[model samples]
Target: MDNLRRRHITSFQNGVLEPIVFDDKRKSMKSILLSSIKLQKTIAPVLSTIRNFYNKYYNTIHPLCFTFLSFLTRFYLISLSDVVMWDESHFGKFASHYLNREFYFDVHPPLGKMIVALAGWLAGYDGSFDFESATRYPEDLNYTFMRIFMASFGVLMVPLAYFTSIELGFSKHSTILVTLMVLFDTAYLCISRFILLDAMLLFFTLLTLFCMTKFHNQSYHPFSANWWKWLIMTGISIGCVSSVKWIGLFTTALVGLYTIEDLWNKLGDLSIPKIDYLKHWMARIICLIVLPILIYIGCFAIHFAILTHTGPGDEQMSSLFQAGLIGNDFAENPLEVAYGSRITLRNTGFGGGLLHSHVEEYPGGSGQQQVTCYHHEDFNNDWIVLKPREMEIYDNETDVEFVNDGDTIRLLHLATESNLHSHKIPAPLTRAHWEVSCYGNDTFGDEKDSWVIEVVDDVYKRTNHIRSLTTIMRLRHKVLGCYLRAANVGLPDWGFRQVEVTCDKRNNPKDTYTHWNIERHWNSKLPPGGKANYKSKFLREFWNLNVAMYYANNALVSDPDDNDILASKPRQWPILEVGLRLCSWTSDSIKFYLLGNPAVWWSGTASLMLFILTLFWYLVRRQRQYTDFSPGFLMDQFTASCSLKTKNMIFGIHYALIITIFWYFKDIAYGVSSPNIELKDKKWLSTWDIVD
Candidate 1:
């Protein structure tokens, strides 16, 4: 009774009295509820005012404001310094090639370079800059215009993002949020403010997604001109995307999937006739599949037409292919091959380089002077072909002397005054075979250096002349009974870091490296067809280029020789775990880092996961509510008016995954346009003669 001091306290409500228990916990909870209500009331005015501000200015004026901000942020101080940053050396050189109409090979498609070239050309650039080693820009060069042009694409990304959000029916605030994320991203800013392909890539990617979403919204009005316009635009955007890099294929795939899903849903609609569904499928096949392919091939065609003259890409292409180029040597008349001919042999194997010899000695296995395969054209790569015991008897004037099978021969290196010889000495890199070295004196080489010509087939084995661009032959060493081969391994400095060549006993004529071709042959006599019969086929040459590009892509992705230091695995990209060194000045003077923004990248990753979870949650809830989770129903539900959050989530996840997978497959962030950094131990690119 004494402890219950407040037990008799009662509250009067509606003229009724009731006993009230004095509970500290209950009172505290009531106080918290009242404070929360009061706080909500107090903030209501501020929230309404903020909403009113957004409603008043966001739709009409905000886009322009965002564009202004993006332009200022990206373009301000863009010409901060004249020093080359990141991939400017590579891309700038490519652009110059375009302006000069110089043919160059790259693993990527040509649209991005073409755009850069167009920009530079419009800016009064004379196409004379080499972009060598981050050298200073020329005084007359309008370098700022080029930088500003590239930044303009980055500027466009902000509005593109904003428009994309709006097209997907997102709220004004949500659109602003998305725009701000892209505008403020440090990675996008850094990459876009330079003359690189990334900004263009991002622009196309965003444009593609926007067009795709617009197309999706018009699905109900299929066959409408507006629908076709969006679909066609999406296809064109895909071409632009792929023109930048092969990574764009991921986005293309997503669009394809979207089209398939749309068609599948249209097929299931009971009101739509089967013929209507067929028409829809046909339209997509034409617009999505065939149209994009044509655009892609068209880009290549334009690329080929613009770059008519030969340049640095000559070695990467086949000898026949190079001969067809306008300014190349073979452009005049195809040279014929004959016995005792001075020629260069290029192996069509994995590395696909020229047989070469230099003064440098082998460091690892045989202590002889190194014999290797180089890709570029060099005087050192020239060799004199001689048939043993016949070279002295035969003269260059002899009527098309044919060196047939079973003929003993020797290759004398013209530059080093040494015979291309092989003995029982094991190869340095490929130990299973004998070693090939520049051995014996020039003029009169050793008997041990002799080799027998072995044509792979019976037709060519019967005393047939080895013709250039016609016959494939192998050189079998008489002493070691082995065939000369390229080992696909780089040698030390002595060999100019080119792939090592060896003599292997295994005679797999199918092996590309062992099968040799006469790349360049000198003979006064003309072939049966004559020079007029020589013709270049565009389709065949294009196919060959495709093959070359495929091999180049494989080498970069796999890093088969483990030479690339900047190559990162796919898993490292999402967490912002690695950064590439764009450029360096000595050890500490200045450096540029190619790193993604931590905040933007991490948030994208988080958004991707959250979107996936939300999608699953929505699907599960739908399944539980309807208990009829049929494909048609689910498709219709998704195609219908989805919530803004759901729409954004889907697009965001798709966008993130597309980019992530693309970068994963490419392995390198800057594509082939970026200069590969050289380390003391590892070499990224095939070694070429350093031209002064």
Candidate 2:
């Protein structure tokens, strides 16, 4: 057991053992003592030398020595499996996208993937491999190098935890307890050995925590160079963690709340000068808010700069942004909105999309072809602009009529041959709004099918004449007096998850979602729009992209139709109620079980519970005015905080007993070319459902 301690101590050269010289009365004692004498002579010098070396160098090299051991634990047999595990498949593909100079979209922010791409580049990977789940890597892919580089981030995490404990005023043995918990956490070790973003995410998380505590310590010397440095570093770490994943926001929020409380305390200090207080507020605002924002934006800028090529993610962006991509030709759209011209209407909202319709009718409300806002363009997106009439066809002859502002026009779906119509029936998703749908053929339509155009183009000029790709306008339902809008209200399954389009009754002048722009107009009679007309500022595009990403992320829900073994509720994570199977379960494949060392995880949970109970106990006593903590009662307060360094040995004894538990489960992390039946003892924890 790793917890086993040495029971025997070496004797000093001048002490212990009677001399070898024996009399006849003690001849038998001579034989017994001779063997012991030879044993001491053989090993005593070596044990003394080791003890001297440890005593002399332990303090100086312990961190380095143990950190190296941590690395070994993570790196050992890391290459045993050449297959991508768990989220590595997803992240690895994103890395290849970067290496190939192609754009892609993900729910997370970009810095972690960008670093993974950098890792691939440094590893000499040429972006040729597709990382399919459970797929073995190719010989020349150099995944090992990338993994090693990524794991380097994880390696720093152990030391970060160690130093963070010291900064938090943990005693020597308490610090060892903290560091050892991190060191032996199977989840941390195994996760670090992969080409996944968690390694960086967790490293930055720990770094942020460490910097927060370190900065708190420097609060004693406000505005000092060290204080400012740590404060700024804390902000940078927050930015990095956030860039890795949205989960980082939890840590950022923790620091933010603490800072708020700190500032509030300082504000109430009557003796503090107003100027110094102002400086404190200004410093925190600049470092905590502005600095992190700059870092986050800088990372996105790098993301946009590197991904200039047209990609599958183009559909998620505005037509203007798509046009700016290297291989997209979306700018070659007609400039004028002539009658009979087929066009796509783009809602001007932050994350709005093209007006779309499908043949599926609403299950509720006015049963008609579903009208929705769709990010992707398709034939269903094409709507023919026509004069407000019941005409079956329009002639694109010499006598042409261009749709203008204040002109009432009927929109006919090119693919479905139905007129865009709105009625008083409440929209399925937005109950307060009118249902927008495609109803009736071109030959048969009512006044409800007609919409009045109100163009409000650019700042330089008022455009009464509608211009494609540049004019901003609103489509008002002629009879109902509601504006066509798309506010990212998702439709039901019958509507295929597209955003609901409704005729909003509210006449909010600044409701961008209610505004419409004619994009990708097609009329053989009109001139094509110039690419210059479609240019957009990076900030505008970035803002809209994030909005779209937020909406998309919000819409993500687990499928109720399928049983997902890998997915677990938040409650299950703390106690290891489920273990994520990282690869296919087979006799031949190398498998990784994503479970933590139960001893560490459970102890952490217990500590949190203990803290809550301790707080409750103190609060109850305070309420009753049991405040005479002169000497005897005062010691309990110190003990409650666990700040008494005098009892470290007791703490260490308990820590080692916990470590023995961790030692039993080490194989689940270190090597499992194939998990044998015996290791099902991994099911040692009642919560681990590893067999399936």
Residue-level lDDT tens digits of model 2 in 152-265: 998998889888877877655667777888888888888899999999999999999999999999988999999999999999999999989888999899999989999999
> Relative to the true structure, how large is the alpha-carbon lDDT of every model?
0.73, 0.82
Candidate 1 lDDT, tens digit per residue, 215-242?
A: 8888888889999999899988987898
TM-scores for the candidates: 0.70, 0.84
For residue 143, model 1's alpha carbon misses the true position, in angstroms, by 1.2
Worst 10 residues of 1 by lDDT: 683-692
TM-score of structure candidate 1 = 0.70
- Tell me the spans in candidate 2 whose CA falls farther than 4 Å from its real position: 1-59, 336-340, 348-353, 357-376, 390-405, 415-418, 424-444, 455-467, 470-472, 486-501, 508-515, 559-562, 617-649
Pairs of colliding residues, candidate 1: 349-513
Q: Candidate 2's C-alpha lDDT?
A: 0.82
